[model samples]
Target: MLLLTCPWCGPRDETEYHYGGQAHVAYPANPAELSDEEWAEYLFFRDNPKGPFAERWVHSTGCRRWFNVVRDTVTYEVLAVYGPHDPRPELAAGDPR
Candidate 1:
């Protein structure tokens, strides 16, 4: 089983958490001014990268707090774990998104 380290509760099984999809997605500044396509894009579109990606996760069974994780999609290896408000860290020279 995969293990995720929660910012508040430390390491826990992946089952103890909830995946919140891609992180760092910004809300539209003017929702009312958006066209149908724009609204749909904002709601459903997300990056599906093959390598390291930033994602949001919530520790449901533990502290029940949200946090961010930079993980490798192909290997399922977590590169970094950080708070929700923290900026994404710089990956190593060989790491790619």
Candidate 2:
């Protein structure tokens, strides 16, 4: 079982949250101006990193606010969780601070 540290709710089981995919992706200002290829990139393309990754998550059954989480894919360890406007720190292995 994965242990996730919610920015607002503290440590919780992974089952209490929902994965919202990769973070730091911004939507285009003018959707109508985007080419099909660009739109496809935004809608379908996703990065599946094997190591530390930054992702968006919702503490669905808890805080419910969308925040960022740095997690390890192999060990299922959460590194850090922060609000959308908060700056992220450099993640170190097994340090969920």
Candidate 3:
């Protein structure tokens, strides 16, 4: 099974957490003025990048807190984890750290 480290609870089984999809998605500034296609895109569209990506996850069974993780989509490798409000960690070019 996959293991995901919670920012507050440390390392734990992936089952104790809930996937919250892509992180850092900005909400529309004026939803009322948006067209149907624009609103739909804002609500449902997401980039499915092939390599490493940032995502949000919640530690439901543990601390019940949400955090961000930089992970590789293909290998399921977690490169970093930080609180939702914390700035995303920087990594060297070509490095996952």
Candidate 4:
């Protein structure tokens, strides 16, 4: 019953979106030289935060762009939505806004 507000598509049912995992992840400069463990770590590991977290989500049934979403893990509350290249401004320390 969570309402996910997409940046380009407006509010939508959660089922229409696909979670794209942590945003801002960059590939290594020298990927050819990476060890197996390093490669696996980059591919599988993530800092799974508990509260308001920034993540990537695709509006699969709508605009189809992968955008960033700030949401609460515990209550499934959506905070904000922005495009992939958006420069997220710093919100107040405790406020979700």
Ranking of predictions according to lDDT: 1, 3, 4, 2
Per-residue lDDT for 1-97 in model 4, tens only? 7788887778999899898998777889999999999999999999777877888899999889899888878778777788898876465687543
Highest lDDT against the true fold, candidate = 1
Model 1: lDDT of residue 55: 99
Between candidates 2 and 4, the TM-score winner:
4
What is the per-residue lDDT of model 3 for residues 1-97, given as tens digits with 9 covering 90 to 100? 7799897888999999999998988888988999999988888999898777899999999999999999888888898898898887885588543
When superposed on Cα atoms, how far off is each prediction in RMSD?
A: 1.3, 3.5, 2.0, 2.3
Q: How close is candidate 1 to the true structure, as a TM-score?
A: 0.94
Which predicted model would earn the best TM-score?
1
Q: How well is each residue in 1-97 modelled by candidate 1, as lDDT tens digits?
A: 8899888888899999999999999999999999999999999999999989999999998888999999999999999999998899997787643
Per-model lDDT: 0.92, 0.83, 0.88, 0.83
Off by over 4 Å in 1: none
How high is the lDDT of residue 15 in model 3? 96
| Steric clash pairs (candidate 3) | none
Which structure is stronger by lDDT: 1 or 2?
1
Instruction: Record all residue pairs in model 1 with backbone atoms less than 3 Å apart, i.e. clashing.
Output: none
How many clashes does each candidate structure show, in the order listed?
A: 0, 0, 0, 0
Worst 10 residues of 3 by lDDT: 88-97
